[model samples]
Target: MDSKTQQTKWSQFLSLIVVFFFWGFVAASNDILIPVFKKWFVLSQVQSQLVAWAFYVAYFVGSVIFFIISLKSDILQKFGYKKTLAVGLVLSALGAFLFVPAASAASFWFFLAALFIVGLGFSVQQIVANPLAIKMGSPQTGAHRLTLAGGINSLGTTIGPILLGIVLFGMGNKEDSAPKDVNLTKIEIVQKEYQTHKDELAKNVLELRQDNQDDPAKVNEVIAIVEKNIADLDTQISSINQNPGANENQVEAYTTALGEIKQRSTNISYPIGFVKDHLKEVKMPFIVLGIAFILVAIFMLFSKIEDPAKEEEAEIEEGSAKFSIFKYPQLYLGMLAIFIYVGVEVSIISNLPALLHTKEFGGVLEHNIAPFVSLYWGSLMIGRWNGSINVFNMSKTTNMLMKFIVPFVAFAIIIFANELSGKDVSSFYIYAFWILAFIIMSFIGGKAAGKTLMIFGLAGVVMMILGLVYPDKEIAKYFFISGGLFCSIMWPSIFDLAIAGLGKNTGKASSFLVMMILGGGIIPLIQGWICDFDKTSPEGVMGITWTHFSYVIPIVCFVYLAFYGFVTPRILKKQGITMGETTAGGH
Candidate 1:
């Protein structure tokens, strides 16, 4: 556990983060997939979120399987970390390959199954990699190593959207491409405005329908107003449809709107689920990513990475700890923390494009918003890269300079990636200040995981509140997106603190922590449900109307995290394990 021993495994440690990178790439890419799936499949907001639910819920299910297997025998102990990781990669490859058939069949269930398999694979990978990252170095610097690996993971997140967008939308060379008849510009504006007002319009119609016992005169007046609004919307649709320039796609879009308007009337009902359409355009990307997963699996199979816990193997064999990790209250709290951490992180990014497409919020299209999505994930990269400077054996002056320099360097990479994908990123220069704030925050914590967790968690709460407070302001969108920066170090911080002195119970405890990823599945669905039109009032049986207000879910999540951060150190102190106090060569 000393610096000298930790320094010896540097090469194998370097290769270990490759799995981390893939996990980030695919996870962030799901945000891109969400809107695309929602549009093509005609899914409701809550229904579209099944994409996240299917993907993340697998972590819980897979961890439970692993936990059950461990109850019978130590899976990781028997198979070893390297083999477990390789097996996970192979399983993920199988999952990625499923996307090909899923797309070909145009089956939403197939897509969910593919994602579930991928998450199942990730379950094993996470259990192995998180503990492996910790075990590779001194216990004191375990979190730092995990933070450094998270920086690599965030790099995948930084570019995942642009790359996936190029593959999904095929818009990387838009300047040289001929225009389609879709009338995207008009559709973009109208869809944003119409979606913004549609909920209120529907609420009014429902209220009017509920007034059967009211005065006939008043009922007639409300019905007349609703009819007039429908007529106006129909007139606009007719104009768009009759335009000389209108193409098949535009006409189809208008026809869909007319259908929706009709469905909103008293005699008709709106369809409330995903519609299956034969979509062959998005097949190749899945096939390609699946093949890549196999290649990575092969690389891992032959790689030089060692069994990470060989030193502790004998002790583990002789140990007699119970299967339950609940004995440690910190572990249970950390499980909750992981649940919400992944929940808040996933939900924020996943729903962002939904928020951006609204006229009242960002008013950006799916194609145009990839860069912003890139920035949200890149914000994490910026913070982690800065926090990771200590992993290198450098001089204090060098470390300090690199801490300041690394974040902007990461930011430049994000900009360059966006530009390559035909996006104009010059508008993002303002985020440099937020990047600086993250750097300042990193230095304030000074390599302490608990301290950093508290600072960053509190920052997440403040930023989310700013988003809710100023939902109509441009700063609100960016503030909510900036939650990624504050969330950058939370996993490492909370993971290290949770498993700190568990020793023999660490593996089972790790499984328990991974199980909490169920939060990612549950929280986003809750947010999506809250954003439903039925939930128009926060105090009602439903929730609020504004899309931005759904952010309260993550705000609540971060509050618990800040509490965990503030109290975890005290918990560790009770066990006489004080972290971040020993001065090392790196920090």
Candidate 2:
């Protein structure tokens, strides 16, 4: 077939990445939501993870719906990419609107349902966007092009948490402006929060003592925090019991701890700032996002974004592919790689709060740890920007120079976004070293997706291991945070390798790959359960070893990714696919 696809379609590619931005905005915002949801709902660690579970699982469900449609006729081919993306945006807008009611009711399930719908719409955008990213540029540079798109997506992840925090913590119902009434629900939210801190502190003190019985200074460090937090919890419980509307069980909760109070725990409305109750502020951001989504959809309707095969399809018989989609090992194995990649990516962020709250780590609350989470996602941007540099035609020296320059620019963007939102940027500057390390690694991976995946995957494994066993707690947390760096380019690597030989079936294969995003939901649940699954602690209590050591889960995930990286090239080579060569743009 005679070819018409350009070496690069910068205009169309630019339009496409706006959708990528929305995906990142919502996805990274979920990390912020998990802890907030837990705090609002009085949910245990495991239960709170349902926020991520419900959201990511929808990708699988949405993919299934579209995949079934493809069995009859191709949706992407029939509807075209712009129409499909517009439809996806409209669906996402509807989900975003649901949050208003979700907030009004303060129902956790309602919030989960809203997130699920948003992810449903994202599933469609992802199906269209990824392949389009590849097709918009030289096939040889497809993986790097996708990495460039992901860097744009990472920009969303970088700012999403900050803007979301502004909405969640700094918005409606100003703390000093409101008067206190007596609603037990507010009291319960406060009580659970204090209790959670107390429980985590207690477990940390225990772990510290066990780790070194001789280190009384270390034990005392945690002992003071544990005692203070428990005192706060006890005082909160007394206040709960003082309410006449409290249930029998609610009163007994305190009675078993200290003694009894005169009243039941009920009828206690709180001031806006009381225990940081910002539930009313949650919907404002989503409402804004919903409006934005509708506008984007309208733009898409008028937009000129074209399909991948649109220009080339005229030269070939439309339905004349001779191979089955299943016969490709790249597709099947790539499906598993996508699952593992999405799983590890999501699981790391979702469980990170638990790690931070560990007394050894700092006992920081979720809102306070936004800088860490922001930097983690920002690490992806730093790496992707370095990888994305490949999309341009440049000399090897120029490419090397861009790799050195671009990652820091992306880092500066993260710094500016977070600092502008009032987060301190002083500590975030040290993260530059990690970015430097990734830059060194990107040079090693070159432009080949398989080689890049293999190297980066092993790097992820090493980072996770350091997070697990590294002696310096401060540096160790950074090690764990570096998971985002290694992960930044894996999606393009796997996607590029998987669809190598499947010309027309790329969309179908992509649907299956997108469906495996179910990992993002399920893997987090597994890790979250592990966070709560302490045999040493009784039921309903937070665990000790699992918080820091739970990093082992990602270690396993990265090991498989590394394995896939090693074996995939062999498989692709057997099929006469050489993915490791320096791609079209000189590297």
Candidate 3:
């Protein structure tokens, strides 16, 4: 704990953060790919979200495998952090390589399987990286150092979309956009969902007929309703196909139906119409990513990265009694909080691309989407930069000044990033106002985990509400984008709170928290499903209109998170733990 050991090992820490950069790079990159994939494969917004599902669920799956293996022995302790992380990278590398065949074959499911493997590698990397970040610095400053690492992760997120955008669609000086083309025969997703709805309608009708054998009229009325829905969807599909064009409502409602008027493409941006060329474009990005992973894995294995001394099974923290996982309310509640927290952060950016495509919004085509996506992810970077201010180890007055100054500095970085990627930076000038407000809120939130969580969670809830209510779609879109601002530091706050008093159970609790990263996958798919809810509801509004209304899902998630923040402190105090006192966190 002396000054020498207290200083963070800058060189070693830099080496470790490379993995963090790539994690955010690939993750934020997923949002960009979601729309591209939707266009490429004629996928529903719901089906398109399988990109996130496949990637994040692998974290749950990998963590489970790790947990099972650890019951016999702690894997990190046995293999050591550096080697374990290397192995994870290799696993991810193999997964990335799988993308080649997946793209070459134009198989969406295969791409998912490959992405799942990438997520599995990240699961291991996440496990090692979080603890390793803390160990790289002083015990007292470990959490602050982890915040700094999270900042690096955010940096990755900020640039990921921008760079990926250029890689996908270079320097934005383009001609006319591609025609909306989708394959009719390959509209299996629509057919599958249709069958599901049909089966449910049939089941309901059968039950009603059984109960109302004497009242055939009741069952017949329900049958008419079901048939009307079926016919409506069919007519909508047929109208668009016969004319070779359709309104956005019809397209969003049954996106895969555009497949009926399939045509080839001449533009690489719209190359999905030309199946062969478009599928070929997909391989290069992933293959390049895979090679980078393998090279990093090799460097990590050979590099002189230090591993902290491992603790024994009996490593009880001072003044703490061993408690079963059942006794920890914060642990369980915080698990779900972590789940919801990760989900909302991810879903906002994931679905924003679709939101941007609508006429009510900017109606920007795919190439134009990078700026908004970049800004959303960049918002996280801004907040993380502020959160990492403690890394400066300056005077209290300087720390306060840094808190105010650092966020703007991060904003500058974001602006610079957009410019570097050859994107329009004018719209970003106004977003600085939102960042300014977040800076003020950050002052109000301070350092306490519970207070920060409650405040930020509620802020997220309000932003979503405003996004729903705001009349101007142009300005309203920023409300949705501001979600990243609120979500910035939630991961650490929830993580520290969750493991606040776990003592010897700390490592195990951490693993479970990592498993909850699957929320990243689950929430977006739910929102996308809501976005594609093509039928009319009892309220007489089209469920497809829920694209604008799907903000409700994120709203509910923030509400629970705010509740968790409000209640978890009281829950932990009963076990004699202070709210702010806690362990490290990772993205």
Most accurate candidate by TM-score: 3
Per-residue CA lDDT of candidate 3, range 492-548, in tens? 889878988777678778888989999999999999988775323312133324577
Query: What do the candidate models score in CA lDDT, each in turn?
Result: 0.73, 0.73, 0.76
What clash count goes with each model? 1, 10, 3
Global CA lDDT computed for model 2 = 0.73
Q: Encode model 2's per-residue lDDT on 73-124: one tens digit a residue.
A: 8677789888998899999999999988887767788888999999999988
State candidate 1's TM-score: 0.79
The ten-residue window of minimal lDDT in model 2 covers 259-268
Ranked candidates (TM-score, high to low): 3, 1, 2
TM-score of the candidate numbered 2? Answer: 0.78
lDDT for model 1 comes to 0.73
RMSD each, Å = 9.8, 11.7, 11.7
Give the runs in model 3 whose Cα sits over 4 Å from its true position. Answer: 1-6, 174-273, 311-323, 535-544, 581-586
